[model samples]
Target: MDRRQLEYFLAIVQTGGFTSAGRRLRVAQPSLSQAIRALERDLGTPLFDRLGRGVGLTAAGEALVRPAKQVLRDFATARASVESVLGLTGGRLDIVALTTLAVDPLAALIGRFRAAHERVDVRVTDPELDNAVTGMVLEGDCELGLAESPGGVEGLDHLRLRDQEFFAVLPPGSAIDPAHPIEVAELAGWALVSTPEGTAMRTLVDRELGRCGAAPRVAVETTHRAAIVPLVLAGAGATVLPPRLAEDAAGRGAVVVPTTPRLVHGAVMMWRSGQLSPAARAFVELARLDETALPPAGTAGPTRSP
Candidate 1:
């Protein structure tokens, strides 16, 4: 019913209870409850079902979630527009990136953005799934999202940033020669330190290995990106990684080599197709400039919804 009520409602949803939401928003529990009650009354329906020590969204609440978030996002954008006159001296940019791409490109991209707008706070989160990036941006949970291009959602605009090349990383003292590229078939029967199934990297690895009449013998399946290289180094198994990460693994005594014919995917930056907050706009411009020096890949430039 109001911005404050919507904020309180979303906070409760995010933190999973009124008590935790109160802690997060620094509002007293009674006041937070009163705000939600007022909102539910105005909407003519109860938003949440009372559960012992916690809460669950009612059908009405579930329906309001997306629009509520969009309203808050628009309000913030409106404020940001007025604040733009003060320059990029202060603001916050929220971004969600695919777990696999977070380190290689997102880290460097954030580094450059911070160098220019040092006062702006940048927050980055990883999506639960590869396709969830588009949903997060569309629902206004994030101003920007980085994921594999040819996004699954339709209401967002995309900028093709760069192409990431995958390589095979083997443990120390492996018989493979670093100078020679290996074929996908050769990796068959070997244990692999892999991310869980359905991840972008895992999908690519599976498809490629499947082509060679083999399936991954997953030695360790984990969501922890940082542990992959270490596991490979520990001789858990070989894993596929992007070039930047593979290079780092090589420096740490892991044998890194390119797969024959090469495995590559296009990394993209995506946003809702509407007015953007100043910080988000500046981040997009920064990406555009960064892309200019690199060779073009899929889509060639920014693409928008019809």
Candidate 2:
């Protein structure tokens, strides 16, 4: 019936119950129930069927879901369009990204974006697991996201930034050949220090190893990307790293070897398929500019892994 009512309705639908929806919306449960009742009265039909533990959308409620979502998206887009005309004065941009990506292209893009629009404030949330980044975006906690492609969410759009190449991070002076790409089978022989289970790198490693019918002998597991290097340096085991990081580690005397089959994965910038706030749009534009002007991957000098 109204924007607030639509918001309450959608929240209930998404969260699957009135109590959780009320908690999420930060409103009293009674008030949330009243609002939904009001919405149902306006629609001339009950939107939800009460369940033993939760609620389910009735036929009418199901019908309202898609349009309600679109309406909310359109309203946000309209507000953003108005804000864009104001030239991004004191706008804020929220972003969620993977740790490894936050250290590279995302960091650079944020720097450039800030320089271009001094009034816009940017906040970045780096999650170790890739899905958390997508979750942040999907839940409307962030306006922008940078991570591996094929986010698998409907109504979101993304652009490929680059194919991030993964390299083997070996101990200092390891016998593994640096000049040639190491086969997955060969790398599996060494006990590996790996990023923890949920990270993109770990997923990549497991998928590749599984495809090869081999498994890594994981010696140590860590959540922090930086920790991988020190463990490897201490000869804990070899680990995989992205190109710039590998290059920097190599510069620091770590044996950086390319992987066999060239373990390259795509990184993308993703946003919902509606209007972005002026600041967010500006940041996206800066990212686009950076992508065009930047040389092919690995062309820029190595950035030392911190």
Return the TM-score for each candidate structure.
0.93, 0.72
Strongest candidate by TM-score: 1
In candidate 1, what are the lDDT values of residues 159-231, reduced to their tens digit? 8877887888889888887777788777777799988886888888888888878888887999887899899
Model 2 alpha-carbon drift over 4 Å, by segment: 1-83, 298-306
Error of 1 at 290 (Å): 0.8
User: How many Å off is the CA of 288 in candidate 2?
Assistant: 2.2
**Tens-place lDDT digits, model 2, residues 109-177:** 888888877887889988757877776676666778988868557878777787777888889878765
Cα lDDT over the full model 1 = 0.85
Instruction: For model 2, name the residue pairs that clash.
Output: none
Model 2 lDDT, residue 284, Cα: 82
Error of 1 at 299 (Å): 20
After TM-score superposition, the amount by which residue 216's alpha carbon in candidate 1 deviates from its true location, in angstroms, is: 1.7
